[model samples]
Target: MTLVEGSGCFVVTDEGVRLMDLVGGIAVNALGHCHPEVVEAASAQMRRLLHTSNLYYTTPQVELAEALVASAFPGRVFWCNSGAEANEAAIKVARKWGRLHRRGAFTVVTLEGAFHGRTLATLAATGNAHYSDPFRPLPEGFRQVPRGDLAAVERALVDPDRPGVAVLAEPIQGESGVNPLGTEYLVGLRELCDRHRALLILDEVQTGMGRTGTMWAHQAAGIVPDLMTAAKGLGGGLPLGAVLVSKTADCLEPGDHGSTFGGNPVACAAGLAAISVITRDRLFNRAAIAGDQLKEGILGFRAMGLPVADVRGSGLLLGIGLSEPWARELAGVALQEGLLINPIGAATIRLAPPLVISDDEIELALEGLRSSLVRVMRDKGL
Candidate 1:
C-alpha cells in the first residue's frame, strides 16, 4: 500500500482511503505516524546537522546513549540504522566475546520461531528455516531450541568442546505469531545463561520502546540480559537501532564495528523526542492498561461467535487466532475496510498499533476486525 500522508494512528493512501494503522509499520511507529514531537525534533536537528562521519560524536547520539544507559541498560550503546543491523551487531558481539572469553566458543543459541533479521549471519541466527533457506550455506554457530523450553536451552548450552556464547530470543516471537514466553521461562533463561557463562541477548527489535508495556521487554521479567538489541519504535518512525550491552559484557572494542548511517543525528533526535514522550506520558504503563483492554476486547470476539480462537501477546502487540486458516483473508478484508493488520503464519492476525493510540481507536480497530471476519466467513460459506 502506498501511503501518501499519515497522522497519529492513521494513514491516507494515494487512493484516498484512510486506514487506521493498527500494524504501526510492523510495530515501528510507536508514537503513531508522523508524531508532531518526533517530527519537530528531527526537523530541528536536520536544520543544524544531518550526517557526519562517526569520526566525530554528535550530541543527539551521546544524549540518547546516556538516556538509555541511565534508565534501561548500563553498558555502552552501538548505533545502527535498523533492527537487522542491531541484531547483526549483537551476533558479532557474541562471536567476539566467545572467542575472547570462552575457549574460542562462538555458538549462539536461538529460539525456534524467532526472526532476528535478513542479514546473512542474522538470518542464520533467525530460527525460521524458510527465511534462511533461500540463501544457502547460512553462517554456522547458531542453534535453535523450542521457545520457552529451558531444558532444551540447557542442552544447547552444555557443549563444552564448542561452548555457547549467547542465547538470543524474543520474549514474544512477533513475526511467526504472537507466541509469548512465560515469565518463568524468561527468568529461567537468564539463570541458565548465567550458569553457562553465556550472554543472554533479548531481541527487543519489535517489542522495545513501550511496545510490550515496558521500555524494554526484558525489564518486565525483572532479569537483565548481558546484551540486547532494540530498534522498531526507538526512532518514532525514523530508522534507528541500538545494541545495548551490560557493563560486564561491554566487550566491543574500538575499530570492531561501525555503520555509515548508524546514528544519524536526525534519527537520534527523533529518538530523543520519542523517548521524551514515552517517559513523560508513562506510555509503558499506558500500554499495559491499553493492551489489557485490547486483549479483553479481542477475546470477546469468541463470545460473539466469531472465528477467533485465541487472543495472545502482551501490551499492544497482540495476535488474534482464527479457528481456521483465514487470517490472510481476514487481513485483506480488514484492509478493504480501512483497518491495517498483519497475518503471521496461517491463523493469527497481528495488531501492533502505536503505544499512544486512544481507547476509541482500539474500539474502532476491533469493530473493523469483527466486520472483516464476518464478511470473510460469509464469503467462504463457513
Candidate 2:
C-alpha cells in the first residue's frame, strides 16, 4: 500500500484508504505518526541547526543523551543512525572490553532466533542462516545458543576452546515472532554474564521506548545490562539509534568509533520530544493496560475457535499464533478489512501499535481482525 500520511493510530494511503496501523512502523512509532510535539521539535531544530560533525556539539544531542541516561541505567551514549549501527557499536564495545578485561575473549554468545540487525557484524551476531547465508564469510567471533536455555548459555560462555566475552540478546525477540525470553531467563543471563565476566547486551531496538510496558523491557527483568542498544522508537519516527554503555563496560577510547549523521540535531530533538511525551503522559503504563485489553480481545478469537492458537509477548509487542500456517493470508485479509498488521513467517501475526492507541481504537482493531480471521478461515475451507 502507498501510505501518504499518518496521524495517531491510523494512516492514509495515496488511494484514500485509511487503515488502523497496528504495526506502528514496525515498532518505531511509539507516539504514533506526526505527533505534534515531535513534529514541532524536529521542525524547530531543523530551522535552528540541521547538522554539525562530531567535532561540534548540539543541545538536542546532549539533551537526548542525558534523557536516555537518566531514564535507563547510568551510561555513556554513542549515537547512530539505525539499530544495526547501535548493535555494531555494542559489538565493538564488547570486543574492546574483552581485550582489556577478559584476556582477549572476543566471542559473543547470542540466542538462537534473535534478530540483532542487518549489518555484516550484527548479522554475524544474529547467527541466523536465512539472513547470513547468502553473505558468506560473515564476521566471526560469535556463537549461537538455544533461546531460554541457561545451561547451554553457560556451556558456551565457559567453553575453554573459545572464551565468550558477551551474551547478546533481545529482551523480546520481535522478528522471530515476538517471543519473550521471560524474566527468569533474563535474570539467568545476567547472572551468567556476571559469573563469566562477560558483558550482558540487551538489544531493545523493537522493545524499547515504552513498547513493552516499560522504557526498556529489561527493566522489568530487574537485571542491569552492561550495554544496551536502542533504535526502533528512539528517534520518534526519525532515524536515531544509540548504544548505552554502563560505566563498568565503558571501554571505548578516542577514535574507537564514530558516525557522521548519527545524532543529527533534528532527529535528537524529535527523540527528546518523543521521550518527554512518553514520560509525562506515562504511556508505558498505558501500553501495559492497552496491551492486556488487546491480548484479551485476541484471545477471545481463540475462545471462538477462529484459528488463533496463542497470543505471545507482553505489552504492545504481541504475536498472534495461528493453528494453521495462514498468517500471510490472514494479513492480506486484514488489509482488506482496513487494518495493518505484520505477519512473521507463516504462523504468527505481529502487532505493535502505537502507545497512544485508545480503547476505542483497540476495539476497532479487534473488530477488523476478527472479521479478517473469519474471512480467511472460510476462504481456506477450514
Candidate 3:
C-alpha cells in the first residue's frame, strides 16, 4: 500500500510493481497521480502559508470556495478534511434546521445501499448492518429506505411519528458498487423533499468533480439539492472536502461546527489546481466520451463468451459485473497481470479511472480485464 513514487496514470509500489492506476486512488486522483499543476500549486502554497485555521482569511480557501459555488452550486460552503466530515457538517445543519423549524423533528432518511462515510453519524446513516453492527448504540435520528423508492421514503418520513428533516443519498452508490439512480428517480426525490418541506442532500463524495460527466451528478437530473457534499477528486490526491449549502438549507450558525485543518491553504491550493485542470482541459467532456467508450468495450466482451454480466455507472465510474461471485478472484488475476481494480461486494469490479486516461490506456485496461476474466471463467468452469 506504500506507493513511494508515481507519475501520470501509473504508480510504483513499495515492492516496485508499477501498475496502471485504474482506481485513481479510489477516485481522489481525478487529475491523475502527481499531476504537475497540483504539485506546483501545493508546493507554492506550502511555501507561502501552511495552516491558518478558519480564524483568519486566506486566498486559497476563499478562492476554492468561490470556484466551487460559481461552477456548480450557488451557496455557502463549509470546508472539511474528507467525505466523512463533509457529510457530518451537512447532517448537523439538517438537524439544526429541523429542531428550529419542524417542531423538533430531527430524523434524516438515507438510501439502503448508499455508502455515506465511516464516521459514527454517517455510519448510522449508512443502511448496511455489517458496517454499523460492530459499533452499537450509534447516533440516533437516522433511518434507511430502499434506493429509488419514493413511496418507501414517504412512509419512512412519518412512520415513526416524526417529521423528516432531510433525505440524503448518493446519485450513484460507489462502495456498494456503481449503482446509479436514474435522472427520473433523482428528480422525484427532489420533488418529494420539497413536497414534504424536507431538505435533499446529495452525497457527491464519489461522483462529483466531473466523475459523472458533469460538474455535479445531481445536474443530470436537472434539479438542485438543498445541500450537497463533495470530496475524493476535489483534493487532487490530497485531503480536502466541501459541504455546499443552498440558501434554503444554510442553517448552520457560527461556532456550530469547525475543523482545525479543514480549510488548510495547501490543501485548498491543490484543490483549486485540480478544479482548474479539470475545467481548462475539458476533462468533464473527456470523462463522458471515454466512459462511454470503455463501457461499450467492456460490454463487447460478451461476444467472446466472457463473464461480464453487466456494466453500470455514469461517466468514468463503472462497475463490471459478473454473474457469479468471482469478482475478487478476477481482481487478483488482474493485479498479477499488472492492472489494478477494486472488487466490491460479491460480483462487482469497480473502475473509477482518472478523467485524463487516454484511449490507449483504456485499451490496456480492457485487455488486462479480458484476460483476467478468461482465466477466472475457465478455472471456475463457469
Candidate 4:
C-alpha cells in the first residue's frame, strides 16, 4: 500500500484508507507516527544545525551518546546510520579487541538463526547462506553454532586452531521468526564468554529501545554484554544507530573507524526525544502489558480451533505460529482486513506494533486478525 501520512497507531494511504499500523515501520516508530515531540525536536535541531559530519561535537550527538550509555552501561557510544552499521562497528571492535587482548584471536562465534545485518562482515556474522550465497567471498573469521547450546558455544570459543575472540548474538532472534534463546541460555552464554575470555556482543538492533519490554533485551537475563548494538526504534523513525561499548571492550582508537552521517544533529535530536518519552512515560512497561494482551488474545484463538499454535518472543516483538503453512496467505488477508502484520515464511506472523498503541487499537488488531484467519480457513476448506 502507498502510505501518505501517519498519526499515532494508524497510517493513511493515498486512497484514504486508514489502516492500523501494527508493523510500526518494522518496529522503528517507537512513539508512533508523527509524534509531536520527535517532530519538534528534529525541527528545533534543524533550526540550529543539521550536519557537521563527525569532525565537530554537536549537542544532540553528545547528549544522545550520554543518554544511551546511561541507559545501557558505564561505557562510550559509537554513532552510526543503521543496524548494519552498528553491527559492523561491533564487529570492528571485536576484531581490534581480539588483537589487543585475545592473542590475536579473530573469529566471532554467533548462534544459528541470528540476524546481525546485511553488510559483508555482518552477513558473515549472520551465517545465513541465502543472504550470503550471492555475496560470495564473505569476510572470514566467523563461526555459527546451535542456538541455546552452551556446549556448542564453549567448543567453538575454545577451538584451539582458530579460537573465537567474541560471541555475538541477539537476545531474541527477530528476522528468523522471533526465537528467544531463553534466560538460562543467555546467562550461560555470558558465563561461557567470561570463561573463554571472549567479548560478549549482543545485537540489540531489533530488540532494543523498549521494543522487547525493556530498555535493552539483555537486561532481562541480568547480563551485561561487553558490546551492544542498537537501532530500529532508536531515532523515533529517523535513521540512526549506536554501539554501546563497555569499559573493558572500549578498544577503538580515533582513526579506527568513522561514518559520514552517523550521528547527524537532527537524527540525534529526534533520538533524544524518543528516548526521553520512552523513559519518562515508561513505555517499556506498556509494551510488556500490551504484548501480554496480544499474546493471550492470539493463544485464545487456539481454543476456538483456529490455526494459532504458539506465540514466541517477548513484548511487541512477537511471532504467531500457525498450525498450518498459511502465513503468507494470512498476511494478505490481514492486510485486506485493515491490519498490517509481517509473515515469516509460511507458518509465523510477526507483530511489532507501536509502544504507544492503545488497548482499543490492539482489540482492532485482534479482530482483524481473527477475520483474516477465518477467511483463510474458509478459502482453504479447512
Better of 1 and 4 by TM-score: 4
How much lDDT does each candidate structure score? 0.89, 0.95, 0.90, 0.93
Per-residue accuracy of model 2 over 1-382 as CA lDDT, tens digit each: 6999999999999999999999999999999999999999999999999999887889999999999998899989999999999999999999999889989999999999999999999899888899999998999899999997899999999999998999999999999998999999999999999998999999999999998998899999998999999998999999999999999999998789999999989999999999999999999999999999999999999878899999999999999999999999999999999999999999999999999999999999999999999999899787
lDDT of 1 by residue, 185-262 (tens): 999999999998999999999988888888888788898988889898887789999999887677898899998999
Instruction: Point to the candidate with the largest lDDT.
Output: 2
RMSD of 2: 0.7
Worst 10 residues of 2 by lDDT: 301-310
What ranges in model 3 sit over 4 Å off? none
lDDT of 3 by residue, 1-382 (tens): 6777888888899999999988998989898889999999999999999998788879998999999997787899999999999999999999899888777788999998989999999999996899989988899999888887899998877665866889999999999989999999998888888888899999999999998899888887899999999999988888998999999988788899999999789999999999999989889889999999999999999999988899999899999888889989988989888888999988999999999999999999889898989989888876
Which residue pairs come into collision in candidate 1? none
Q: Model 4 Cα displacement at 74 (Å)?
A: 0.8
Ranking by lDDT: 2, 4, 3, 1
* Residue 295 in candidate 4, Cα distance off native in Å: 0.5
